[model samples]
Target: MSSEKQMKVEAVTAPVDLGEGPHWSVKEEALYYVDIFNQNVHRYHPISGNHSRMHIEGGPVTLVVPHAKVSKTFIVTVGRDLAVVTWPDPSKDCVITSYKVLSSVDAQCPDNRFNDGKCDRKGRLWAGTMGATDVPDNPNPHLGSLFIMHNDAKVTKVVDKVSISNGLAWNVKNDTFYFVDTCEYKVESFDCEFLRGVLSNRKTVYDYKTSGLHPSFPDGMTVDTNGDLWVACFGEGKVHCIEPSSGKVKKDVDLPTNSITSVCWGGPQLDHLYVTTTKKGLSKEQLLAQPLAGAVFRVTGTGSRGYPATECNVSLPK
Candidate 1:
């Protein structure tokens, strides 16, 4: 297998138990990510080289997006509920009381919990779900699903029977939406009607399982300005830039750890690729080999750029 190599990558911080869900704050000039197993939300300032985390008491925070209207507020998926939370001040201890629950998921699938999510250009929160870890051995992965939380406080089920819903991205034109169900080992695309937040014409854009080029599955993803999709390869320690139309791998950037989980583009010009990895399931020997397993990394000089993240404007009932 051939790989396109041009970007330079490096670790920027120490590792977290499960460093996932990376989000770039253009306004704050900071990067935010979550430590899923630790139930913590972290903030990192690249220039200052400072890092801090706030504890989420009851359940883990799967993903977080900036509020569309409020500068210091955010919309996040906490456990099986949707919430509006304030960005914690790094100078003070993060208080759990700052979060307000806006919506709770279906009680029918109590084993299900929210996983990866972000706001569409229309400011709607599109998030996916997965089975809770507490379930019995090898729980029903098919129980997972994807959902849309609208700006008007309405919730709709978009896709069902999904297992381990992970990465989500949209083309620069906003006409196509890409999704990843990690267990399926493929990145799927759908025709997206942005105004109404409707998706149709589902098709596979790329299949890692069939490609046999890598030993990992696709996790988190982001789209570039040139319309290529950059996806993190869990257990493979690399991120790939793929051409969506042809479903071909155009480029790949290797990392120091094997469990890379997610990626986002930030920096003033949106040229920096920030990545997150995990240290969750490594054996003693494996951990020793990848001491930076759960740390966050950044890749620069990639000759590509990404679109800005749309803020979450969905209104939550007080």
Candidate 2:
């Protein structure tokens, strides 16, 4: 574990309204993420310090995953719809050349929208939705559900009655699935069956309420090569590395601002940790005090490495 003094944390992009998902694409040798409120997808190349964004004009773009078999195409969740997007050039800011909606969920709840998501090693996408957060920092509870998008483009509901479906990760062995429902304030694990795309043996791995880390919400997360979980603490402004087996906090990496949204591993060796944050809901005083609230940050010298992000293998509609 790298101490706060030894860890290197640097802002990598200009502040956005809300920065959420941070994914490192090994193939492109770049980092990809989304600005939900701004309705855009951004790509940042660490080597050249070049950053570009594509305006997603449908709705709030929650997450973006590269397609396993298609180049320049991706699987993204725009509002309640699971969609496909094509980005012809990533070196410059541009509009998506093509867009297609595969399916939409929460038809009965007009305010429900997709939140956090990621692909399994098998290239299956697992994403969840959250009820409207009309009230600042308070999302409607129990209206969300988790779903899996298979390779055939089939969508199936896996878990129901969720509140603020947030961070998600799968273990190195691909047999355990870890998740977070922000409202619950706990990290839960599930026994995974990749072939059938099902989860069982649900158990709480870490409880924030009891861990003395209150007033903070567990948001985005990722697993390191050692199978430990790195969870972003939204209000706490830190990332806690937890050992899944013992559910113990192995280490903590503090950020300069609150409202930390997500984290991912980048760099050629997958040893750099990339973090995202949001400026939404901040007051004039809070904004003044936290100028870097919405900027993307990169932390290195954590003494750990992460696995390459798995691309979505879902076949697009012909």
Candidate 3:
């Protein structure tokens, strides 16, 4: 559709338990995503309509960032460890059989697990950890933390006292960074050092308020070429495109499912908008009403464009 308000949403994949982390791979011309609870990594070829999946055994792969230099290699955040996932012979078989742990998160905080993450412009992997679900009734808001994995595989703790770290993106100018801690119900900004993977001067730029959309907790986020943020509202089934300066809504894309998890721009020209959803906490009736809850959806011909996704420039050690 030509109108932004009346954009068409199409289902790209079947259902997943908790679908998150939608990343576009320019090299493969495909969309890469994960089902966190299902512990599966999926790749979809837009042209052939071929969808392939591989399940990780021990833990869930929270996010996948394509390596900037190495083909078929990704800087992955697996469970609570910073790891590298690579397809040694993808031309022969598509299954993922190798993943190496670059560094282990501190064992003192057993409740922490890696969640949503991405890389900065300079190729450093920036992933955040969240409290484990075993203690949902007593979620330690301060236990979660954000970290940076350098090119040499050194990990650094950058932000502390975080809970449910979700969306992360830099402005179009690459001078400012925006991050979301879902428990806070707000999007915060900081001065960014693209080369060093450093952040400072935390300030709230866009805060969420429940309107007709209850529990509009900010989840996954992405930046268009315009520097505006398209943030998925977890319980609202809506994605808000907000301006960074005044924190005002530019446009909203509504979907049929309530638990909208993440969004990214893909396709050849990076003009298509891809979204991920979840069915984790739905009741029986809710599931019945929204049968396509856990599927990945996309909005095509939106008249908007996205920046070329930054690849994970940091390479894992051999």
Candidate 4:
């Protein structure tokens, strides 16, 4: 395990209220993340050191993933709707020319909103929704579900009765799918049928409560070339690298704040780990104590590289 002093952690973007769902765009050579509460989508280019954000009206924007075939077009989760958005300019904060709502989820539960999401190697978008967290860490339980958005605009619910549906990753071979439901305090794995978009044989890979990592809610996650899981521990302020096969912690990278929200692999070589955090639930005293609570951090020198994030393959209607 590496200590905080041994890791190179630096802030890459200005603070955001509730930062989550980070995606590295290999085509653009930049990083895109969302500010959930503020309803904003942000972009940062590490090469030119340019930072910009576009306000997304209608509802809270939880994620932004690039389209596999379209330039400047992305699939975003706005409130409960899966919308296709287009940003013509990358250098400036410009209005989105196209915001097409494809389909919505949990229409019965208006309080439930989209959380973390990512595309599989097959380019299918897998996202989840959670009940409102009006009281901070204590979210309304069992009002969430995980869904897979097909290329044909079909949304299928894969898992239900979830609380705070978050972090997702697939194995190197694409046969195993990893998921996190924060209230469950465990990391789960399933046999994945990528072609059919089916998941079965669910098993627990890591249990935070049993491991004694109390208060460390598992949030966004990513996988490296070595097939290890890097999980952001929201309350613990650390990212724990776990060997899924054995469910053991291989390394730990601590952050400066407790509200660590999500993480991704970026940089030209994909060797850098990009992390997002939040300041939504902190008190004034706690905020003062942790000054970098809501900043996006870059951690390098981990000796691991991640595969490029898969883009959503669905074609937008003309």
Question: By lDDT, is 1 or 2 better?
Answer: 2
The global C-alpha lDDT for each of the candidates, from Candidate 1 onward, is: 0.83, 0.89, 0.81, 0.90
Q: Give each model's clash number.
A: 0, 0, 0, 0
lDDT of 4 at 161: 88
Model 2 TM-score (2 dp): 0.96
**Predictions ranked by lDDT, top down?**
4, 2, 1, 3
Q: For model 3, what is the error of residue 88's alpha carbon versus the real structure, in angstroms, after optimal superposition?
A: 4.5
lDDT by residue for model 1 over 44-134, one digit each (tens)? 9888877877777768788878787876677778888888777557524475645788788757888678889988888888998888652
Give the 10-residue window scoring lowest on summed lDDT in candidate 4.
133-142
TM per prediction? 0.94, 0.96, 0.93, 0.96
lDDT of candidate 1 vs native? 0.83
TM-score of 1: 0.94
- List model 3 lDDT by residue over 40-138, tens digit each: 778888888878776665577898877888887777777887777776543333555557888888477875789999877777788888887622233
Evaluated at residue 294, the lDDT of candidate 4 is 94
Deviating ranges (above 4 Å) for candidate 1: 1-6, 88-92, 133-139
Q: Between 2 and 3, whose lDDT is larger?
A: 2
